[model samples]
Target chain A: MILTVTPNPALDLTWHVEALSPGATHRVPTAAARAGGKGLNVARVLHGAGHEVLALATTGGATGAEFTAELAASGVPHRLLAVRAPTRRSAAIVDDRRGETVVLNELGGPLAAEESTALHDSAVQLARDAGVVAICGSLPPGFGAEHLGELVAAIAASGVPVVADTSGPALLAAARAGAHVVKPNREELEQATGRAEPLAGARALLDLGAHLIVVSLGTEGLLVVGRSGAPVHARLPEPLHGNATGAGDAAVAAIAAALATGVDLAADTDAAARARLDLARRATAWSASAVLMPLAGELSPRHAELEAAVVATPIHEESR
Target chain B: MILTVTPNPALDLTWHVEALSPGATHRVPTAAARAGGKGLNVARVLHGAGHEVLALATTGGATGAEFTAELAASGVPHRLLAVRAPTRRSAAIVDDRRGETVVLNELGGPLAAEESTALHDSAVQLARDAGVVAICGSLPPGFGAEHLGELVAAIAASGVPVVADTSGPALLAAARAGAHVVKPNREELEQATGRAEPLAGARALLDLGAHLIVVSLGTEGLLVVGRSGAPVHARLPEPLHGNATGAGDAAVAAIAAALATGVDLAADTDAAARARLDLARRATAWSASAVLMPLAGELSPRHAELEAAVVATPIHEESR
Candidate 1:
């Protein structure tokens, strides 16, 4: 079983309007809702791929109840830890006429110290026997960078590979814990390393102890760097553009699924190198496929075909 | 006690974003939520003014639960009728830097015919001893324009003057029912009568048997037209510029309060004519005061001062 932990999650509300005019009232013909959060998005994608997944999240208040209801409706298996603060809500407005979309997100209220500790314990305990454990999303209140590192350490000690998809101090914590794989988008990478060059920032993350680091470059694609191998850049031959909201999460899900399905990660062996290349292709394809979907946490069936369309190019050490 | 009925109510979610960029993820620093709808706004304003108020709304699902929770927290007495579909949620993204706000609203799902009938019955029963009964906002699903007319007739039969704050076919229905007071904005009046001239449209509504018609003209203030008196233009000497959301609702609430407290509505008589002018000045002051607030359904204490600053100009019949 694959274990997914979302420290902070939200209910995503989406509305469509003819056009968006600032300081004006808009009539939305309809609105759609879904269970949302960085980790929840990954969990949904993994579950959709027919994997046996267990999602762990903290929920409370009326909004939290509603969020859990939506999660139940989404058919993802989950263990909810009740808390005092309501889960946050996120909204997106699509101006169909202008083809523009605006997203608004709320930072969930502070989590009690006891509840925060309970969440860490739950995540660690749930990781047992799971081939892959993916801890994703923002750190909730009462959780510092050390909290993320501690969770990673506990999970990693169980012999299960831990993948972390987060940003800022949390990403630094996961890297320090030497997470098996760390995914950081371009902006996050820059922010974490304070480096202008994506490769320089990615290298800094690798040096910080992450076994492998995948730096997402938005429409540009992924830069995969390992502690002991030539870095590679992976992308589709042509950019397949759609909604990019959950593309990064899709990549995280693909990597976690790959680890669960027996893809070797040791970069020293020739077979391991092949496994890494194969993993890169799959991650690129999954990320690309996510764009074809209108909502996050969803993947298109054409991902298999897209996998074949991905091309990974070796980046010389001198390029950095 | 002031009684307000909102057939279609929603949870208003307001997000504060540094800026809005189409198709980009925005991190909302904070989000404020409140009970929202025309009647609810007026109810809140009335309640805020220390008036005994009861707000009646239909609610269901998670969003509705949140809406009711917020209403309870607001200290407004409310009765929520259970429905099948989840309550709708509206979102507003304020771009502070640009001084602009974009709103997106979802029309709640259609109400079942039986559910609609139950709502009407509930409103009529609740109006038994209410000093003023205000039927406000859009007609929810399963309700035709005729449904509004039926509701007005029922409420009016209970010896209570029904104040309708609505537009379009519902306004037409209310007029045909001879609602004691019907509040329509300039745009609504124009749309309902297909007349560009506000006076002409006001006359048409008055001819439809409305006892009084107050046409809101935004910053231009109000145009009050009764069955007998010539139309009067009322305004604050200087427009109070602020967020205009819910300002109209405040005006409606003030007018309702004025009537309930004993402002004569016999427009054909000279004494009643003087009462109408007094009511217009008070209503315009309340509307103007609402604009000074950051939140809908709230007003600053400066309403009294603004009331003394209002000027009402008599419009001769020849203009119509």
Candidate 2:
């Protein structure tokens, strides 16, 4: 089974408003709550693609219980290590009229030292038997870049490949620790290298011990960079709109799954890129259908298409 | 004893951000959650003033459990009627620099038929034993205007005066049921009477069987109207610059406490008005201090002074 670790998961609460006028009262038209975090999103999309995925994370208090319940309802298997503080809730107020979204993200609760050690131990134990272990998202308060680096080293020692998707100091640490795959968006690459040009930054990340680097460019497509091969480019079929919340996670899920299942690095890169574009298309369609149907039922068709598309792509990369 | 009922209480979550720009990600500087609702606020404030107050409301699920825990932690006596659906949460993003607030309010979960009946029964029992009972805030989705009318009538039958603080159709129903007191802000009064002049609309409400009508005019203060008496006017000592989220509830709290303790009604009217102003002042100070300190530890020293000032003012109608 593929294992995914989300260090700081969240309960994402979304409220729909007609328009957001500052300092003015708004009556919400609708509201929804879902389990969220980059790793959790990857697990969910992978589950939709018919993969046996286990999600591991540290959870706390009432919000954590709610998050677990939502994950269970979504049919994604999860193991939660209980903690003392409540899990953070991130709020998104979507104004459909002008397509504006405002996110109010809470600084996640602090984790105890023992809890952090327990999480690293769990990751090591799970990585021992897993094909590929994906560690993603932000570190909770109290756990720093070195903590993530230690976890990457632990998993790497277990002889299993690890895929790391994060930003800032944590991403820098993961690259330095020799993560097999690193997926960072264009801005993240620029920030990581302090370079305006993403091509150079992607190569820089690969040189920093990342076996492969995938740089996502919002609607344009993705760029794949490796140490000994020419970079391959994959362009999405169509321009998409709506929330860009989970698009990167979808890409990570596809890449990790393909790599674990013996797909060649370059071919898997192309498949993963296509999978994200497909997910984006589905996510937009799902949001539109949510207007006329319950949101829960609107995305199944698109999810099925994404699942099928990822499976059809050949595993071996062919020279262009 | 004074009783306050919140049919749809919430766990109020406020995210403090330096600035909120739409279609962009923001990192909140701080986040706080508290038990909140009109009646709950009234009960808490009254309890702080050394009054015997009972808080009654519907609660369910994990959020409800947390709400109850918070109330207990604050030393407020409460009786929560369990409902089938989880209580909703109201989130606000406060922009400190611009003094702007964005509210995303959720429609609270609907009450089952048994839960509604149980709430009415609880209200009747509390009304029979308490000196004054205040029914506060909006009805949850499952309740109609007639539910407020029925609740008012039941409380009135016990010879305990009912104070209704609400707006729209619920205000109309409460008025028709002959509530002892009804407080409506200027805009709500306009909506109820379809008249731009709030005083005229307030008088019309008084004629509809409401024994007393108080119209809140934002920072200008309050206007009290009754049958066979000249309208009484009370203004704040100073203009308030903060958002008036719970000023109306504070007024209800002061009125209920004064009436229960046998303070003169006229005197209490002025006292209630002043207390409302005081609550506004304290709330502002508390919010600003909360930006720097823990919210519970941020109660302003001015609170006691404001309370004492309100107690000193006895309401006396000039024409009465």
Candidate 3:
């Protein structure tokens, strides 16, 4: 079982219109609402892939109630801790005429201290039997970078591997907590490590005691660095053009799925190294497949074929 | 006290963005949500004017719960009859760059029959003590035109004046019920009566048993016709260029305000005729003042000055 934590989740609403003219009235032909935020997306994808996952988050107010209802309707297992403030809503207006989707994200940085603690406690309890704990997305209001670090340290103490997918100071905090794995996109890694080079930045995370780091490079693929001082790169043969909104989260989902199925990512043996490499290949394939879908937290049906098509290679310690 | 009934109420949301490009992400700098629908708007405006008003509607689900909460926060007295479905949301994305406001209205015509009946029953009961009863906006799903007419007649049975602001079948039904006052914009009046001329259409409504018919002509002013064969036209001397979204609702609010204060619109005496003309003048002034503001259910502070500047003339039957 995998436990996913989304501290600041939202009810994502998408509306479809024929056209958008500012200051004019438009009739929405279609609309959809779903649970959103980094960890929830990962949880959704992982659950969809036949993995047992529980999503934990703090929710309150009307938006929070709607979020809970939607999560229930999705049949996605989740536990919502009641808070005082209302959860946020993210609206995406899909204008098919221009092949554009305009998104409006409400700033959700007001999570109180007590609320954060409540959410953290619930998450830790849910992580007890979980094979992997994936801590994802933004910190709520008053939940600073240091708090994220403390959270990571506490979750990692449960003996369950923790995968931190976040950015900025929070990413650095997770690394310092010895999170089993830290996933950061290129920009996020650079922000955390102050290193322009992806490999160097990932190494920076490794130096902070992280057992593994997957630096997402968008269409360029991923740079996966392991605790044993080895690096593997994986990518599809060709770049696919589609909505890549949740690709990074899908990658985290794949990692959690691998961990749940007994893939030994931390083992230094030859068989373990080979398994870790294969995990990277599969994760990269799942991410690539996700890019072909229109909705986030969902995947394209071609994941199996994409997984078989991923090419991976090992990088020597001193590639220079 | 005035009782306003909005069968198909909604949570109106407005978002301000620098610019809108279809298919792109936009971060809203500001957003506002208000309880909306024709009768609610009238109720809000009347309340703002220091008049006691109660808004009654069917509400349920998360959105409906939020609607009730926002209404409570606004300090407007309201009765929310619980239904099995959620209320709808109407979003307006204001793009200042293009000087445009794009609106997206959800399809909101799927309410259950039992819910509609429940709302109507509560509204009729509340009307007993109300100085004036106003039935406004579209009839919700399963709430037909005949139902609105019956509602108006039932409310009128309490001897309280009933003001109906609606269109097409609802407008015609209200007229047929001998509603104390029926307000319809030019287009709606024409649509209901199948008459190209506003005056002719308004007269047709009077023949249907409406004691008074007000045809809103936007900046051109208002045409007030009574069953006794009198027509009074009132308008601001000059047109104001601004948002006129809820001007009609504002007019209805003014009429309800007049009735709540004991102004008679159906008396056959000369003093009553004079009072009815004054009501028309005040309502037109309120409508004109509303056109200068951005939000609906809100009045400009310059309403008094606008009211004094209204030009009105009573037309004899021969002149028509």
Best by TM-score: 1
Candidate 1, TM-score vs. the true structure? 0.95
True contacts kept of 2: 0.81
TM-score of chain B of 3: 0.92
Q: What are the DockQ scores of the candidates, in order?
A: 0.72, 0.59, 0.46
What ordering of candidates by DockQ runs from best to worst? Answer: 1, 2, 3
Tens digit per residue, CA lDDT, model 2, A199-292: 6887788777777777776655566666654555554355455555666776677667766775445334656545444433343333222222
How does each model score on lDDT? Answer: 0.85, 0.72, 0.82
**Residue B241 error, candidate 3, Å:** 8.0
Residues B1-320, model 2: lDDT tens digits: 89998998888777777877877778674467778877887787678767898999988887888787888888888888888888788776777777566776677888878788888888998777799998998889777689989999888877788889888999999999988878888899999878787668877887887877777666656666665434555554654554456666666765676567653343336564544444333433332322232222122345445433321222454442
Question: How much does candidate 2 score in TM-score?
Answer: 0.85
For residues B139-212, what per-residue lDDT tens digits would candidate 3 score against the true structure? 66588898898898888877888999988899999989889999999988989999999889988998998888
Ranking by TM-score: 1, 2, 3
Regions of candidate 1 where Cα sits further than 4 Å from its true position = A317-319, B237-241
Indicate the residue-level lDDT of B98 in model 1.
Answer: 70
| Chain B TM-score, one value per candidate, order as shown | 0.94, 0.84, 0.92
Candidate 3 chain A weakest ten by summed lDDT:
A22-31
Clashing pairs in 1: A23-B101, A101-B23, B111-B141
Worst 10 residues of 2 chain A by lDDT: A289-298
Better of 1 and 2 by lDDT: 1
